[model samples]
Target chain A: MSAVMAESCLTRNEWICGEYLRTRSEELTDATVEHVTITLVAIALALLVAFPLALLARRWRLAAGPILSLTTVLYTVPSLAMYALLLPVFGISVSVVVCGLVLYSLTILVRNIMTGLDSVPDEAREAARGMGYGCARLLFGVELPLALPSLMAGVRIATVSAVSLTTVGAIVDHGGLGNLIYTGMDSYFKAQVLTASVLCVLLAIAADVLLLGAQRLLTPWTRAGRRAGRRRTAGIPRDSVMDAPGTVV
Target chain B: MGVLPDTWTWLTTAEHWSGDGGVWARLSEHLYLTGVCLALACAIALPLAMWLGHGGGRRFGGALAINISNAGRAVPTFAVLVLLSLGPLGDHGDLPTIVALVLFAVPPLLTNAYVGLSEADKDVVEAARGMGMSRRQLLARVEVPLAFPLIMTGVRTAAVQVVATATLAALAAGGGLGRIITAGFATYDTAQVVAGAVVVAVLALLVEGVLALAQRLFDPGHHRRRALAAAPATAVPARTAP
Candidate 1:
């Protein structure tokens, strides 16, 4: 059954690729690059908007709850609906794509930033203030650096989610990896579909690993826990593994 | 009414609720699709998560499992639905749709379960073992129960995702609330779109509320009124001594 399916997909691809392999490959590569670039830009925009607002929200509980809740509500709206809503205002262009992706990233980003900032021990803040550091200086000098790990966690989640949602923009002729999936689906081209699907899955994995590596490089604190986790697992029995400290029970 | 002209007409239409089928029938089908997909996801992901969590010296394998799940998370549901439909799975009615939904749901469930179980308290596990509990007993009685809250968090996230993504099933000829939204979009019928959107949002909220209640029931500490009933007598004393 697997062989037959593979043969059928290959035959279908051969039929579609009659004389356009070069062109199609170029298109596919271009789509992948375009998707990545647009998604990164959206995430950057989200971080810019969300980080400050999240910090401000932390200081004032009144602002924090409503802002965070609003972002959560926005997050719940489906990507398709968000794109459709944007079309009227931004039209079928990069603007619509960017707006949709950025909005989606905000909820995760804001929540993470706020949580990270709040995670900074209160005593640290008091000490900074006692030393004559102003609020802005304290936030920039003390809070931000300590909050890096949590902030990166949010960024990682946002980036992956953005990459996934970028495919949806294909519905409006905004070319991306999703466009490849869409074309394959419309024409019932199995090989094209499979290739695109496999690439997407790989892209997600690669992006995640890269982000994880980046997290380790930037946040040294987590490295000890990760290393400890590794040592505890090495040569350990399955049952003994659970007894390792910091292993979630 | 004036502001939402499209939504106003849709709310008044017979087709919105009862042209070919009654409201109950339409809703039942939608709920059915959502329920089956979520259930299948839970069945697959729960065990997978448990195995990965318990599987030691296999951190690389665990990371691979998580990476696979993260990949699933990154693929848009509609794109997966399209891929499955165009592939060999197309021969099965709504099978592709269910498969895509399951794929979509699995990542969160598996990741959360593994993370939750792996994060289980070490002292608790030691205590259970010191008390002479077997590996199976430790897992079943202590680890799983303690991990329940985090597992529920994964389920909650997965549930919301499934509810929202199931709308794409309409594109694959599987009946769900998405059909209305898609149809509404094609014809520029804002009312139909509004009706569908409203129903889906309400359905999502309903599911969330039900799950929230379930979570509260499962979590003894969530119910403020039951605080006195659920707390162990030694907790306060233990904290005070420290």
Candidate 2:
């Protein structure tokens, strides 16, 4: 252990070390692009599949149980193990990484979309139906809009987790920031590892924050309702209000 | 499949299970890494989350802690492991890996425990307080007990995650089942890699199953629900509210 420490410490001392100068910014940029591509593609595919599945589950309550259980089981499979399992079929390709990531995102996405759809107020549905709105029209116009907040939260979670999980795909050379980390580990390049790891974390945070902003921008009423909720629940204590129905936060 | 027989041969061979880098040794190392990190995380997170849930109120600090931990979920485990292992914390054997895994484990454990306690029926809590229970008593006897299922769920989630992730320890020169997979990759031995993955998958499933069973056993309310569902006559109660 001491030898290990001595080697690394000698390799890259702190207190404003010049290790950062050793890293290639252009390589970091390329890695960032790859990371974003993998994350976006996986999330998009998961969302596409999840929306329809969520609708089906919402349409049939019994189906919801089985579908959710299946997804949860899939979700429990470790990222590395899943990737390894897929290796036999996909053979270290981008498809394997994206497929594994999409599977991971599905449970969260489907559950959230279903819950969001469930949370659409009944009176709004009644109003839509009374106005001769067809099921499809109501879902597109009324139900989906109201479900935006929860759906956005789910998307934020799915996207961020996808970004993180993409790092694991580096083992297969999926061309992401993980590649940097892997190569760094192989060569014992401390600068390369630190740069890549920090960038991955930063990218995740940036994506999460961006999604949060987008959710706020899209759902004005949620923010308004939250303020109104705060005013109405002012007299009550904190924990009690937390349990209140329809409390956004 | 072509891979299965080869994987079986690799798994069953005594050579694969014997030696410093063998499955048994590696599995023990993996378990040790998981066990230590998980214990450390639970010790730190459980009480803090429970306290925050039971009495810390809805302060900004508590909310901030939960939010930061949730964001921790977004940070890739591999990246953290790599960074820690190559940085100042590097070369400390499994210390870097444990730190990374512990950070990863804390978010779910903390969130679930807090959310579970908060979601415990308010009416039940009121009743407990009405029965002359002190604040501590109310938390311990009523809230924590009520929150057992979700808390156990958190533990199960964290345990499975830790077990699966402990594989990365090999990348940092720390011992674990991951070494088998990595070595297989190095040698282009698909069977060994597949076998290592199978072992990990099975380990994760075992942890999940054990924790789930423990949750059900510890939480009498879950048993009561099972009993109620099992007996149809008792379930409906033979009475009409109408």
The sequence of per-residue lDDT tens digits that candidate 1 reaches over residues A156-247 is 76777777777777756674887887777777676666666666667766787798798788778767877778956443222111211100
Interface RMSD for each predicted structure: 7.1, 6.4
**Share of the reference A-B contacts seen in candidate 1:** 0.30
lDDT of each: 0.71, 0.77
Specify the poorest-scoring 10-residue window by lDDT in model 1 chain B.
B233-242
Query: What's model 1's lDDT at A211?
Result: 84
Query: How is the predicted docking of candidate 2 categorized under the CAPRI scheme?
Result: acceptable
Q: Please write out the lDDT profile of model 2 over residues B1-242, one tens digit for every residue.
A: 68989999998999999987888888888888889989999998888887777775555435644575557666677867777787778767678988888888887688778877877899999999999999999988989988887788778878877886687666656678888887887888888888988887788778888888888788958867777778766344542211
Most TM-score-accurate candidate? 2
| DockQ for each numbered candidate | 0.31, 0.38
Q: Deviation in angstroms for B241 in model 2?
A: 24
